[model samples]
Target chain A: MKKLLLLLAIAAFCMPTWSADTKNLKYVDGTTLTIINKPQHDGNRLRRINTDKYPDLTSRVRHYLNMPTGMALRFRTNSPVIRAKWTTLDTLRHTNMASISEKGLDLYIKQDGKWLWAGFGNPKFEGTKHASTMINDMDTTMKECMLYLPTFMQVNSIEIGVAPDSRIESCGDIKRAPVVAMGSSYTHGSGTSRAGMAWPAQLSRMLGVDIANYGTSGQQKMEQFFADIICDTDADMFIFDCFSNPSPKEIHERFAPFVKKIRSKHPSTPLVFLETVDREWKNFDLKKRKFENDKEQAAREEIAKVIANDPNIYFFEPGLYTGTDHETSVDGTHPGDMGYQRAAINIAEKINATPALKKIIDAAKAKDCCKSPCKCPASKK
Target chain B: MKKLLLLLAIAAFCMPTWSADTKNLKYVDGTTLTIINKPQHDGNRLRRINTDKYPDLTSRVRHYLNMPTGMALRFRTNSPVIRAKWTTLDTLRHTNMASISEKGLDLYIKQDGKWLWAGFGNPKFEGTKHASTMINDMDTTMKECMLYLPTFMQVNSIEIGVAPDSRIESCGDIKRAPVVAMGSSYTHGSGTSRAGMAWPAQLSRMLGVDIANYGTSGQQKMEQFFADIICDTDADMFIFDCFSNPSPKEIHERFAPFVKKIRSKHPSTPLVFLETVDREWKNFDLKKRKFENDKEQAAREEIAKVIANDPNIYFFEPGLYTGTDHETSVDGTHPGDMGYQRAAINIAEKINATPALKKIIDAAKAKDCCKSPCKCPASKK
Candidate 1:
């Protein structure tokens, strides 16, 4: 039994964190989050679609039956109190809506007598029964615990700040980073969750940079255009792609000027172009197939041409694989959380293309560096 | 064969019209995206991160290459564009950092000539190769086109507005919603993007109600109470999830009266409570999981009791099982986009328990309205 426990622990630690779908899950030492802004209570009223049918109630819940993303519920102060949606990536299928003890509903609260959270008026609602079909996970995965507090202890309103206090204070003078993207709805990310997907956010993590996201949903070049809200900032650059929204004409038209605009501003900022990602083009429309063929050739040639004279400009072919399919979207255009991870992987790869990595690879080729194929350079040390 | 083609076309139409992964693929319509929101520029700066080894580049790319999110070349602007991560949905293997792309990346482009809307920094660089696996039905998802347009077409700035001309639009002056939230970092949608993955964002979508989200990265709960700019008049309710950071003593000592304070102003408004989300219990050291576990439970229960008699004061179970997982995090405590989605789903389910949705369900149950299951009223045609 001792040996078995040891093996389990080792297996858990040594396991490859990344699976076939997303980036490798890194075991973080501690979690940290900071709120830049909190949800504000705006007094705008929705046209209240379908409301006459269910009057006197706040909103209807029927539309959320199967959507993985939907209208999230919040209290007047903007804290999320209730949520409704279609499907979730929760293969454990642990419904947050669970009514504990077959009380049909449960809530959380502080033992000291404050109300922490409450549950549905109809506590009898059982959770979704078909847990197996609800998930997309591994056999080894177990159901994780999630609890709903009983009503008496829930509270409202609080401050927002960081933890463990990373010595680095402040984002520092609102510095901005130049950015470009290429992918599907996952890239453009939709809904009122402005900037939620991360093409704009993750970049902030990598380079301590800020950028504007110009991605759109469900647009594969049908209404494509170059950058809008081009600022006068000296810190602009361009990154172009035609992967998720494959269109020969749009790419054919936008690539050069897009690059030119950034070159016009931050001429020193490195410009990079991207090749299309992979999927089953043949599986879709004939028009898509035709466009894809044209675009691939055009992309390669244009990339070759652009880089021929300008060394600062570069190109990155997507170097990862994603595992979504036609059914990956709640509506097909917007990638759920899974698709967003795919976009991140591809983006991360492009980020890896810096000159430092190139030197590492060259060193590996020469077989003069450390034993590993890739080596980190001696840093500021 | 003709009949088969017709059938195939019909089938495609019946399928969800959008997919996050399948950009430019087959859609029921032959024509592509009708210009929803006009395209705009998304830019970022590309400061070479890996300079020592690669001398000319930055270290940003080097770190990216180390992860599984494949690489893609991007253009830079104000900030780095990225796909924020979410907790592992137990359904998809529960590996937080799975490989998202299999082969070369898929490029997505808005239909407009917008300059580098994918974000600013160029992801393309030397040595970034394509992933080996490929997502299904995604070949030719997009085409990378290049062209040197006549000089007249380029511009300096364009606005990426939300209007009918764009994909999303809101009308009228209500300008606000019933509820709002104020919190520390936990309130800010972190580890996820702003548009689609934040819990508040997801909750708003689920409820079809406008929720104001003001989450910042790395904020602590203390900051919310200190925030005093007023936007409180429009709201109908408020909720607070400060427990994500509060100590047990804090929950008992500070949370309850804070809620009552807000209630003093909007006496008619409902308030909800939230338990903090933490993962210390998962791998809780010698310490009993009781502190985190029991406290979370107590908080949820207390809220329920308060709301038991009042229609306005409601409680929600913090967790439930659906098809997804809730145990995901980069640092373990912060919920990823998946976690946020899960949080929202939990809230949404409880919202379904509200008297509002129950009235509809009860009426349907009374008549035994539909086919196999208890039928609810049909959606308004």
Candidate 2:
């Protein structure tokens, strides 16, 4: 008994103190938390679109809806360490993308009125289930935090974990309206290194506004269903990154009708169209160069006709999205982290310059402070 | 007999025009080519270090020597499409790095007196044997080109493929003395997206100088053998990225002697010691923060002592290698492509500022023309 007791004592000493203590951590449903950069869904916090309501949508669109591309959980916590336990729909891996950008979470902390990259939940390669400590050894002061969801992979379930003695609570609903963005892989964060480094996510941080990403990775062909989804959503503005994936014929056939569908519901809302980024490989590939040029030409013609009648419609021409050097892409198509960051900066500058869009962005920036009327301690500073 | 002959004619018509035509292409051994950015090896063009003379070197050092890192084949071709057939020693893949950076090749073409990214030989995932058409369908114009070798994997054999009618010839030897860089994975191009995007590779392109990469990843522990290799190599400048991998104790024990070994042979050569990059993750992880801090402190102390004694010795303090945003890394430890680019620019700036280094770099810039006395057509521009 004495020998056994000695061995047990030794074992207790060797074990990490936090292992047993972590059991005392409180668990909360992700649905109860404040979600940013997502359209209102039917109680499914993990999903970007309400699948039941959009049952008639294509299988690919329905599948991509569960990815939560620009969605994030907004909360306030005094926890020294932030942990996450989540299950991914598929442990997806891309040769050009970092694993963290595909299936892991990115944590940002609001420090001195700015959201800074604090930590990342690096997912494992073999399994769908993942558990990671996002950040640790932080001071136990109440901090406003945002945890960006995986850009490429869907999440089945997720639970934010904190220390036993700490508290985590929702930041409540954001009063400012979101800018709904619909597009293909460029907007879907394909080549970006981290989940939050996606262009839309970067824009949200830059403009201090919510931008709901409806990117479906080569599926944003300006279908009637996508237009219907965009029209149904309550948003301050709409941006289309719809030219890159679809055939030029598809653009000519669907462009006018797609705009009409959205304008029917919210006629005066700011509608922005992004010109397709010229692929770097097209510089050498003659066939691809012609193909991409035709698609852009078609998009420009369609946009010109639509904008002639619509007062609030705006067009953003391609402006050095990846710089003049043409070295920013991973696969000569989709933008990498540097490209995304550059695109976001250029796009944000365009948005800020437009009078109608700038008003909404400024309003959103004002509301980003705690409780609109500026009650938070940070506002005083 | 007529029917058989007709069938053969149809088969010949169906086959690609280049298939049989490529048989006429001249195969040149890599050693005979103008192999830039590599130290003198015992007739082995692919290796960074000559293992025959250094028989007592560590197995890891011997293995890492096979990776080409910053080496490139300088040649000129008028071929519309560039193709490559190569066999890798290992079909290495990292989740964070793009496949093209590890085992594939990157091609850059000189345009209007500047080297522009033209194409890449993207490696397949499953096999060691790889073949790829890097670029296609360009106007037949004589273009000066450089093909960067793989950063991580070893190349067993490689062949450059061109049009049957076109000629590929070496640019002759670079007249300027090369910069020999020694270090760990950062110098080895771990997190960079492409082989040519490695800092040393980028530096070469930026400064128009040959910077020989002697980065041996985790094995760069201030080994005496590495010091001996540095002493033996004919270089104008020597840079050590040797602080990142070694333990503080190992650094304290070996750093002074390592510098001494190099100084013994080439006392006047500009020897630069780089301070390790501050990893972004260390912001939250106190333990790692402390560990890295201690290592940097140790390196600084050792570097200070060496600099005090030797007038030619220089120490470069860590700058913002990955920018202030802290979102530039693929993993928090290794810098991504953007980080590498930033570091290269900063390091190049520091090198350019030093009068002793500036003289060597200016000489290199002058020699980058077709012939030493400004004979190239571009020099007139």
Candidate 3:
């Protein structure tokens, strides 16, 4: 009996076995999905921020507050699951910040024409502090997926992993003129659950275009440093949604100057100036109500002064944050997911109908916006 | 001159270093924040689902699906940032899955009596597959915070790290018997940007109590295996919100039996049976409308049959999802943060008002549920 059992065990061992086929697995950079807002940089850092002249790091907040925000990638793959390896330069932990998946990789896949939750990569903290780490084993059977990078951490680089035999591909070239939005935490995705659920991200999904988010938390003060960067950035359109961050005095002093700086660089690019989302509780609180209303009027006058001479500039009408109430905010300052969605749909409609923006979209379509220009569909047609 | 320069650099490094005071930093296990619904296990794994009798791991979804869903902890810390280290057992990868902050440690802190964004621990994926990782340097100045575990991955164990000099304390004791919730994806926190944003988590925060989330995605069938596990769980209340996953036929056939099983174990425990959240599109789509209506009727009927004789069980009133619309969900089935909050507030009010439930809360208040019996505040009071 023992000899027979041994023979059976040997036979089982000799039989061919199936593993994940990892040997055939290949790593793809997934760059085609529009690594939005990230400019080319030397060294290991991938920065959406143009921090060439950022102020000295005074506190830990300074170290973490200026990493990439609203930067993400979309792609398609046949792998049942996706794995990744990357590292962040800063580690800023807060209970709410950490709980919301900030500074970590988040994924959503299109399933049956709707985006579904698949899973997320885990952060293993070991090895050299300066180098990258691996977050493995996300489960999904979908062929296409969108990845939102960490909103608060600067990643050195990222490498997408799949089964050795699986195929990986990026979402191709930026199909439309990218939408560049600069603002405060509202644009930076404060109350939304994940980076992809932010207003700009939702607009990107709705329009099937790339929307680069340059929203910084508590830092969108119409600084010359940011204006200089915007002048140098490449975008078919620009949206300034910083009414919530700066005071009325600062708006009067700096709004026109910033617009002029950008106009000097890209005179014909379409620009959209958004007034602040209304405070729902203003009717009940007289003091707070007056403060917000006063800011709104000042912003309106400043935007009017800046766009009066620029034919390409338009103001996004107020009431975009309709259906909002006290519950729409995380803490009466940041819009929750519901409020974020309202803003996204409103902006998507405004941008979709604007004639100046239409021209940019139409031109990109006519030219086929193809990275491989030799194989341009418009030329072939 | 070169030697002198080196000497100066060394002196600079050695003279009264102003770091976070490493010697004062201490590592504490955050498991005290109500590791609810998890059965005592001898290994490092922290599992909320009844995996002891779980079905075969035929698909990647099944493997990742059965891991922790809403298992989290709450504590107070004076540390500017809270950090953690953990290891996951299986590394399942998918684009949508990897893009989420799943299987990752997330943190939230209380600021001005509201939870605010702090930061998150970065996972380092290197070295042996089964080893610990250190997610360091979360920036904070808050003295109190809450931490949520990964939604998808099975963590072996976790160690919370703080500045060497900072003190770490669990939330003293659960103020009430932890609310143990069992259901489908909604209970699992689908569409929530972070684990703590799930409906149950929201309830926990709202009531200042502990909640153990045992929400399984696509696996909330009322099988005897699961019923057996629930019989053993320790909770102040049991909320069954699995109407979306089971068919009317299953409700008629198995619902009463499952309730009876729990009643057999704890006759007086408060039980709340909830119908599924109304499908937002049902009002507009005929087929979906019928399907949802049928489920609602079946659940109502089943609850009636089970609660006919039992005074402890109560049917959760309809309209828990009253303020919701299609936009409140990621997909039609799962609630986003808005939907989740609406449900949480509604349910919290109902539970707070229920006579049977209030008895449980009152009793708990009278006898403190502190971790260390010697430190029991109720006795002292």
Which DockQ values do the candidates obtain, in the order shown? 0.03, 0.37, 0.06
Candidate 1 chain A has its poorest 10 consecutive residues by lDDT at: A130-139
> B1-381, model 3: which lDDT tens digit per residue?
997687446434433212333444457665554343343232233565445454642353345445666665556554543557666664642122221235555455554455543444444432212212222233222245556677756666677777665556664433323568887767876655455567887776676566677677667768765577678777878887878778889878888888889888978888887768876544222345567788889888888887888888888776346363244644345666678888888888887888778676556544433333224232210
Off by over 4 Å in 3: A1-197, A200-239, A242-256, A261-336, A342-381, B1-25, B29-45, B49-66, B93-101, B110-117, B124-144, B170-176, B280-290, B319-322, B362-381
- lDDT per residue for candidate 1 within B192-302, as digits (tens), equals 322234465456445644344333233333332322211233444555565555556655555455555555566656555565665522332112234667667656655
Q: Report lDDT (Cα) of residue B100, candidate 2.
A: 77
- TM-score of every candidate: 0.33, 0.87, 0.55
CA error at residue A80 for candidate 1, angstroms: 35
Give me the runs in candidate 1 sitting further than 4 Å from their true place.
A1-337, A340-381, B1-158, B161-174, B216-233, B278-281, B284-291, B297-311, B319-327, B357-381
In model 1, what is the error at residue A250, expressed in angstroms? 21
Sequence-dependent TM-score of model 1 = 0.33
lDDT of 1 by residue, A216-330 (tens): 3334342212222222332334444434564666666766666566566556555555555443333333334456668777777767776887877777665223343321232
Report the C-alpha lDDT of model 2 over A1-381, residue by residue, as the tens digit.
Answer: 997687446434432224324566666666566778877555477788787787678888888887888898887876777888888987356766767888888888876567777888878765899888887766565678888999889888888888776777776643234688889998898877778988888888888777888889989898898888987888888888999889999999999999999989998999999998768887555556778899989998999999999899999997327777777877778768888888889999999888889998887676664432225433210
